[model samples]
Target: MKTSPRLESALKKLYTAFHSNKLNPECNKHCAVGNILDNTDIWKHLSDHHGSIKLNYIGTVHQRIGRKFNGYSPLELLEIEATFLKACGYQLPLHYKNTKPKNPTDKIILFKGLSDVIRILCEMDGIDNVMDYTKLFEVKNQKAFYDIV
Candidate 1:
């Protein structure tokens, strides 16, 4: 798949941070993209498994045959997000870890989350994907960017 300029730019930034020794190697495992692809059990089946069962409060009104379509859905949007990274031949951003490092001198620190990469690429492709996981959104350098969010 052809990647947009924004995806390329995000990839460059990721490599820059990685090369600068600012990101941890395990960051990919915890990325939003990774969380979906690694954690979610997904597979294509010709027919439903008889052993599998689910309780839907409502019938499969959305599905033509009481089954999900093989395409993008609101809840499964993240399912295909991994493809975006693959298309760009890149991975997600290094997010700030939830816990602090034991040693103060540790150089392996995380940055922002995967949404940063997705947003830039999506915006460039005219796919409006907005998300921010920052604890506190701040504008320290207004002159540096055309938009803060």
Candidate 2:
């Protein structure tokens, strides 16, 4: 599926922001990621509906029928979801999940933007075709030091 122009624009902006990596001694990774997500309209629907990013993020991802990712923070969960989807070769807006991992690796590469992540998050609660939706993308040789991915 093609992303809406507004979503696309948000993704491009987020992509640019990600590359910029605002340098500040006080800034943390979660804040950096959250700030980018906060700046976009991707998660606005859920956030507003749930009254907070933390709640909407948790409810959407936790209630979803596909790959469910959660963390101590919304941004961390968003990163995990995006990284998992990108690893499976899913382009932005399209989706695949629930596939069995073949020799699952510890590494997950995240290349998509916040738009991609928001779509994935929104899909979790919808009715999914069990046959078509079961696909989990695996990664190559890389180790994750963090608990999220």
Candidate 3:
């Protein structure tokens, strides 16, 4: 599939965010590391199964990972991610559960639950594909804040 320059630029930004480990801080503690580890295995499986499945939208990709764990509802997460993606200037493809395509090859994109706005931002920075699990730790450090009186 051909990717637009605007999309490519947005993806580059997303990649930076991912590479910088910015969004990992927000993942639920119990699930965060596990998800990252599982994702690596899943990526391997996907690569073997589908032979290099291209990620047009990283937020959507994460939503799939969220679905595999059975904690959060995938659809809800996808919606939240979609909202965030839109904020980052990427138009989300329509989502219809009942009419979802039957074949993986037929599907352009698939998003499950509420989207993580921050995660979407990270993806827009060009962080779609991840190789190592430890890299997620870099995103765990949250900045401290002081309130004005």
Candidate 4:
């Protein structure tokens, strides 16, 4: 899958933001690896204030607010992804989805969606590899992370 330049730049910026020691004044003294995992208060603060929440590919943003709603269709996912790409300053190719080969050889053609976006975020943050994390968003046993490879 071809990634947009804007997405690449965003990934790089997120990587630097997460790994730069200078950004966290007390990182060495107080914030250890285990602290991030074990501390509930710290985790809550990160989720609530740090924009750490991830979007769902299957569900719209409103569904994230605990409202019962149907998941996005494949075409809707494409539209949403295009919006995200534009927001990140990238112009996606015209008829991007239609450009795919008519006779595809791959048995499992993974559709890039919001899950892929979160995977990129996780990768940039050095939190977890795609395999360890992407399973959480998998539907019907189709692994999004594995599909990337």
Candidate 5:
């Protein structure tokens, strides 16, 4: 399946970050959106706080003018961050008192966040989710379509 160059590039960066133990849900510079934006915290300025979808003045201006950062609009970047944080069990509009994972660096937790971010990225590009595995459980003639082993 063909994918946007931007999506391809973002996925590559995410994969590297996930495997290198650099992906962190709590850190702006190491989260899913951070990795896609080349591990930069500049995207944080798009919102008033972390894990928020509400765009600030600058973010609103950029979105109004259709400005894209590394191929995603300001709003889209915010959505990606929010999605990732949510998947990692973080409360919205992250705060010191908000609920968050105990082990933010756990590989299993990070993988879940990455999976959700990838799904959103694919959705943004109008493509099927590559991480979806439910197809393997499809039934045909009352039998499983694919072997689990």
Candidate 6:
């Protein structure tokens, strides 16, 4: 159950942001990757457009050099952002006229986005999805298998 230090740190920050109502998909400084990167907008420069998986010149250089920002590569960061945006109901390559959620700050909306990002994070760390609870519904020998503790 060991987690990477970088992943642990990012999860801690993201958890804090979620509960503090700081997670906002429309704001660069409050978005998923932004929170993981300490609410900094620097990661935005890694891509030419928001919600895009394509890396820019700087992002490509960093990825090619094997640089890690807050434990994620430049491309990984972009994927995280794109994943979050998509889960939040944003149109790809986010634009002012692009379709988006009616309420970007809604708890339900944010939760969905957070869930997807967490799955991606776990994948990046080669771990099981922490948010997955399907195991609780397992059935064994025609009996419900559950863990009470």
Residue 133 displacement in candidate 1 (angstroms): 21
Per-residue lDDT over 1-149 for candidate 2, one digit per residue giving the tens place of the 0 to 100 score:
34444344434544564456531111222222333444433433333321123436544664453432221234444443344334434343322443423322212323322334545433442423222322343334664333333
**TM-score ranking of the models:** 6, 5, 2, 3, 1, 4
Q: What clash count does candidate 4 reach?
A: 0
| Model 4 Cα lDDT, one tens digit per residue, 30-148 | 12211222212222221221112333443333445543212222233233333323333233332334243332221121122223444544444445544355465676655453443
Q: Which ten residues in a row have the lowest lDDT in candidate 4?
A: 25-34
- TM-score, every prediction: 0.23, 0.26, 0.24, 0.21, 0.91, 0.95
* Model 1 spans with C-alpha error above 4 angstroms: 23-112, 127-149
Pairing residues by index, what is the TM-score of model 1? 0.23
Residue range 32-113, candidate 5, lDDT tens digits:
8899999999999989999989999999999999999999999999999999999999998899899999999998888898
- Residue-level lDDT of model 3, residues 1-149, one tens digit each, is 24445334434543444544433322322112212333222322222211122333542565667643222233333333335333333333423322222432111211211124334423444554222244444543373243224
lDDT of 1 by residue, 36-115 (tens): 33323342122132111222323223333544323323123233333333322333321243333343223332333344
Q: What is the lDDT of residue 46 in candidate 2?
A: 35
In the predicted model 4, the residue pairs found to clash are none
Query: Each model's C-alpha lDDT?
Result: 0.36, 0.36, 0.33, 0.32, 0.92, 0.93
Any residue pairs clashing in model 1, and if so which? none
- Which is better, 2 or 6, measured by lDDT? 6
Best by TM-score: 6
Off by over 4 Å in 6: 144-146
TM-score of 6: 0.95
Over 4 Å off, model 3:
1-70, 94-149
lDDT of 5 at 98: 92
lDDT digits (tens) for residues 12-115 of candidate 6: 99899999999999899999999999999999999999999999999899999999888789999999999999999999999989899999999999999999
Clashes of each: 0, 6, 31, 0, 0, 0
Poorest lDDT segment (10 consecutive residues) of candidate 6: 140-149
